[model samples]
Target: MVREFKLPDVGEGLTEAEIVSWLVEPGDTVAEDQPVAEVETDKAVVEVPAPVNGTVKEILAEEGEMVPVGTVIITFDVEGEVPEPEAEAEPEAEPAEPDGKEAADGEPAEPKDVEATSGRVFAAPSARRLARELGVSIEAVDGSGPGGRVTEADVREAAETSAGEEATEEAAADADSGLKSATRKVTDDADEDEPSTDTDGAEAAGAASETVESADRERTLAAPSTRKLAEEKGVDLDAVPTEQTQDGEPFVTDDQVREYAEAQQQAQAADAEAVSGGAEAPAGGPDIEAGGEDERIPYRGIRKTIGKQMERSKYTAPHVTHHDDVDVTRLVETRGRLKEKAEARDTKLTYMPFVVKAIVAALKEYPVLNSQLDEDNEEIVLKGEYNIGVATATDAGLMVPVIKGADRKGMLDIADEMRDLIEKARDRSIAREEMQGGTFSITNFGAIGGEYATPIINYPETAILGLGAIKDRPRVVEREAQGASDGANGEAVSKEVVPRKVMTLSLSIDHRVIDGAEAAQFVNTVKEYLENPELLLLE
Candidate 1:
């Protein structure tokens, strides 16, 4: 009996998810409750477990394809008697469009006859969609997938070949047109005795058309990472010169893009210098050509989610940032004293743990900083719990894993749990629940070497704190000392400038919820706790 498994709503009410990877193949036997695939939702990457024990039959959805909820993503061959309803429906479903392959008229095609299997072309649903979009006939595309199945790459290659052919025909037509025009010009100018002008015009027309044909003839080949690098550097992979080829096609690499970008910058600088020196510029300006085509990256999953959240936060809230510097000499000393003790207990100590403790302590005193504004009810909802979201930067994007009951956890405990959560977030193995239920957020840009930054408040949370790199700076301090000239019964106070470790903090708050004075006082309280690390012990 064959059992179909539909994708479930993983949580957060996400409408769709992209299949990141498959853990089981078509022939592999899977146990019940075992993870069969990893799917990336808007919140996090989660594993989808098998619903029943069965042999893998077919994968209906391809990796990186965003599938809607309740879509049948896979089918399995289970060892059981088929249910009566399913048994009746199985025959009907088999003849239906299992892969949703459609005709060019935007309608489902008729089911192919089983007897005509010899001429049938096997392709993934996504490949079929691409074929329809590119106006390429799927039957003409050679299969490169397992068991001679036609794949997306095969369809794309077919489309490119067709385009090259069309370009060649167009170029030939252009050459013929130029030849005819040149002939006409020569006949008209026969009495003028200047045939060289017509010849030059013909050659120029041919050169221009040839350049366009060459640009359209072939597409650049590059890995996704190389393409991403090129996009970041604002370099056109098609314009980048490369000596490497893969499968007889031009291949662009990261190093090649970087070198070309450097050369472009140099050329631009030379042009600027020539202009400044009143020198005549080159006829065509800089030699860099525009990109042939734009690269499209699917805007889905975590990246899209982040963009939406940022847009909402920026537009919905009027943000105000308060910046201040705190003397963290005592905080540094305290962490140094506890570092060995923490490592002794198999936990690595970092300044973040102390900062978390301090933030919690401050939030306890100024509850407004740890709250959400209920816009629907027009009320202020101050949260009683301290769930601190530590904003972590991952390769996929920024992820915030919350530390529940942060007020209850000790510094070392926060350190241990934070380390585990960060590791999980970075590897994309974190659960969606682990990233939820936050009362406040913290982003430590200091780790990457920034002094101060105005971080956006994580929506619903009234405020977010940004931490900067700690450095040694001169500060004035007053100390009690004996009289310099004569011995006195009472000690005299003296002021001296000394080097102290300090860190800058930027606190951004929603102005609608938190007043400027309140935000400033809240930061002052946090600074007090950090400046005197012993104060956190009382909390």
Candidate 2:
């Protein structure tokens, strides 16, 4: 039976999705839970898995095409009929036809057949280029690679053996002339202690030796460029062995030839330097065009979803922003001291966990900032549970994954969850629900070297907090000291400016549900927790 697979909603309120690519084709076998297609939803890119193990029958959705949810995207054929088994049994009943012995050339001598290696052969792109340069037909080479794919070694072997056969025939046709020309040289090298062996035996031995050398020379396979390089460097291609081989013949590639040439140059340069008492000149870089101009990128996939989300957020929310600076000297000290302890518990303690905890606590103090506006009902709905969304910057765009029950988790647990969620978001594997149920959000532009940004509110959420880069700056503090009054009233007080760690904070809120006063108070609460990290322990 054939079953159709539909595209399901992978994200919250997702109506349609774009098919990024199809990984399976008709006649390809697939397993249950194996990914058959990659689809981009409104929030993230996700893989659609196969529901049953079967052969892919058809693909209905083309790559980059947007289709609505619940539409059939692919079809499969499960547990095909018994006709294949019957055919196999028929071949076994007729056992007299042995393919191996049917032809004297080891394989079927006939060219065209059902199982002929003449149509096409799978090969890497680089392998195909080498075969073309060597004038070898890749389709006719016997592939030893997995699934009968023709590799570069296969092509090189075909070229070498073909060249060898031609050389052997030429030597055979000119045997008499070659023997006469080498007569004097053979006599000079004959063993005098062996009584100057018979001229007939010497001629036969010499001919046999020449044939053997020619056959041995034919066993080495190399591409045309590599052959030329070996010749220019005065290196014998057959002397340089390679791990990659086809039919037990050593195949040389471009890299192997270059490596041999480089070694030779280095040795020669060293010898020259020793003799002349000076070093060789270094190589120069190539002269290429400066810029990568004329490049255009298609705006689709995750970028498309991010653009839509940004537009919706900007148009839907009337935003108000507030900025302030905080002294995080104490927070830095606390983290430095407790870092080893946090590592002992098998977790990394970062500023984000502290920020998340502070935001959750501030939401408790100012519940209005954490509430959502129900425009259809004309009511403000305050959520009791804290699911804080942490905005992370990724290669694609921004992603806000929520921390479920953030108010109930401790700093270490929150840090672990935030780390995992941030990684998943960057890798585009986070589940759709993980980005939902947020009452508030936070963006740390500080991590990317920004002092502050007017972060747009994550739609439906009332507020978002932006963190700036922390740096050392001068700060004024008040202290009481005896007889330290400034030349005025008799109040003994001292004020001095000293260097301290400082950070900038920005808060953007939905003006409909939150007022400027409420946003300020919420930020003040967060400042209190950050400046005095001890307050978090009490909470």
Candidate 3:
């Protein structure tokens, strides 16, 4: 009999999954529990196994197509019984409206034909689900079910039996567990006073307890951002105490977490030092050197996105970058005053807010810079509103969190949102949604000391601006003395480039979405604002 294998509920309330690939095809003989396909849900890639030992009759879903839970994915002919056509034919339907009565009331519908009995023993819904995972035919096992019913144990035993058959004499002969196999025997010596309900309850508790204990060794609990932070801080997963308890409450404070992380780094360094001293080497073993191999990890996350984007922009957008040094001596001094004024208002003023203001002003003059090429539709998408993406580097990878409706927000709001987004990115709290839908991107690599770099364009967006470190350098300046010929101020000052502060800017753009002329003009516009400083606050 050919049995239809509908997609089972793979827990986690998964609603749908995308078929990643198929391992078995029609006419291929597969054992019960052999993987037939891989499906990718939002969480992970899960293997879907055959439920019956049979030849695959058909595949119902194609690769990469999303299928809902309970959707049939494959069919198999386990026993090779072809029912007579008459037996398989659908029963005659009642007249429309079923003689004027709505369907599914007191009149019971005909039972759907069952190609295979659920071969499970001692079944709770969860146990039945687990049995399906173990690939054991519920029918083949002894039922310890409520009334001679099979349970998870029967399913597991069946799996182990099959697995044992594949091993060599030694390993198989020595009682062993097979691929999540375990045995549970329900004893008849139960206390007579124990309630009937308690019997099933005890079995479930045992199963759950075993599962939790085993999973503890393999998995650790923490928020995604917390994990990222731990990695960046070099905190070993095993050594870090769980901040959360079984009741799912956090007990550790952020300060305590940070301190613990720092301690771990110190301990690791001490261990390395001790090893180098030959104190920790195996007795009489050759001394192994510590830590010298260099590795080039491919830029991932935000960095990777930045790279692809810039490459596309440079090659496709016809990029022409115009460079001109700006004289921001007076602008720098003005910024100091603004900072003091902002401090009085309990708002911190950073150079970025000024740059953002400038960019906004320029966008009004040149909207073409904020457009994307819809190559498939052969059209350009000129965004009417601005949602800027700010490139942030976290320990795990780079992230570009967007500031939606950026053009509509005031400088203070923009600054606050930018601060919040970057912090979240660094902490790994930013979601995938927060990382997309930007008409433009700005990467401030200057904080890390680079003067200027040709930043890659953030795809879908025409360009990305890379800001470099601001440093001080000497320049010709007029020094005033009694209105006579004066020498330039040779000392360091905020406004004057007196060997104290200089900044660099790099802009990567998609050549296809933007022209070289347009890119240059945009950069020039930004430079003008940075140079003048005063223009950043136009009332």
Candidate 4:
């Protein structure tokens, strides 16, 4: 019995995924729950595990193919059925050949006929596509992949060999034609002017044909976006040098293409300067050639998902940003005091945990900021639980990992769990559930050196707080004089300016649900807790 496995929805309502790679091939035995393939959804990359123990019978989908959910991707022979005997059962060596004339003639068989006589050929889908593009016979190329699977490189090499043979034959045919034309020219004087004209026309036609053939031979391995980049930059993909190779072919990336294009532009600039008597170019000016082309990345995967989410939030909600600076000198001092204690417990503490606690305390006071607007029911749903989402930057894009029951966790616990979630998010190992159920989000652009930014609210959530870089600035402080006294209250006051640590906060809220005054009050509440770090203990 053969069992089929379909692509499942790994993320919430995910309709499709790109097959990144296959870990197992046909005929390979797999265990239950074993990962057979890795797929990239709009959110993250996840492995598809086998449902039961079986030998892989066939892989229906190819790497780089976008497969829809519920589409069968692979088949497994659960009953341990042997398929080798079927090949041996055919009596005639050329089972599919009706005449068997090629065998009788002692000529070698065609590569495609081998598969017809046998069963299916073991080759990657990409290899087959490349073979078709290059006009190479895939069945004729020897595979270099595991289990003797044909790869893209094998097809390219075979195409080169075929092209060389065709070129030789064409040269020979051209030579014979030239010889015949020369002989005819010597025999007939009436058509004397025609020979020179015909020869010139033939030479011109041959040169154009060679140029086309040369362009066709310039092939290199690159992703679709990289290829697009190369085209836009007016740089040939084959001309780009790269240290990476996929399936034994030179693989070009978007960065490599950009570097190559920049080099070309610099070289051209130097050449122009040399020709113009070494005139110095404008300082810090953009090169006209470099500015002509715009870099384009394929809008898909995590980046695309983020774009859609942002668009929805911006268009659906009227966002209002309230910016203010907080005196976190005490908060900084408190974290410094607790830093060593956290490290003693094998934990690295950061200011995020303190900020999270402050935000939770403020949210408790202003429940409206922690609620969602349900337009369908014309009601504002106020959330009772505190699920704080920490917006983390990753190689794929921005990912927010939510901390559940944040109000109940201690500062150290929040630090530990937040660190764990951030690490997992950066490495893309976090599950979907870990990123969901957030009532509010915090984006710390401060970690990257930004002063302040109006962070868009994570959709379905009412508000998001943006933290800016902490810096020491001069602030006013009032103090009572040591010995001087006035008749009233018997005290003398003095004002002084001193340097204090300050952090800018930008709080963006859905204007429909939270009023501007309420938004300002919420930040003020957060500031009060942060200014006196000990007050967070009462939360």
For 1-539, candidate 4 gives per-residue lDDT tens digits of 67878899998899778788999988799999999999988877888999988898767666775666886778788855654542343222222234544544354344442332234456655567666666555556786666677665466556555554554466456544434332332243546454442343343333323322212224466654456667788777777766656545566666666656655554443334334433345579786664554655546778889999999999999999999999989889999999999999988999999999999999998999999998999999999899999999999999999999999999889999999998988877788889999999999999878987989999899999999999999999878887666567877876789999999999999999999999999999999999998998788
In model 3, which runs have C-alpha deviations exceeding 4 angstroms? 1-127, 130-331, 431-433, 478-497
lDDT of 3 by residue, 1-539 (tens): 76889888663566656677899876689998899998754323467888988887657655644556776767777756663332344332322232455335332232222122432223333344545565444444565434564444344445545654444344333322211111122333646564442223333333333321111232343332344455566554444544343223332222333445544433344344433432233558887789964443423333554556557656666554434455555657777877877777766778887777777777777787787889889988888878888877766555678889866787777777888878877765555577777888888887887775767666767777888777676775544335443245544333333453456677766666667778778878887888887776671
Q: lDDT by residue for model 2 over 267-313, one digit each (tens)?
A: 44334433433322344846568884343344555687778777888
Clash number for every model? 0, 0, 33, 0
lDDT of 2 at 519: 91
Query: What C-alpha lDDT values do all the predictions have?
Result: 0.76, 0.73, 0.59, 0.76
* Residue lDDT tens for model 1, 435-462: 8889999999998889988898899899
How high is each candidate's TM-score?
A: 0.68, 0.58, 0.47, 0.68
For residue 86, model 4's alpha carbon misses the true position, in angstroms, by 6.6
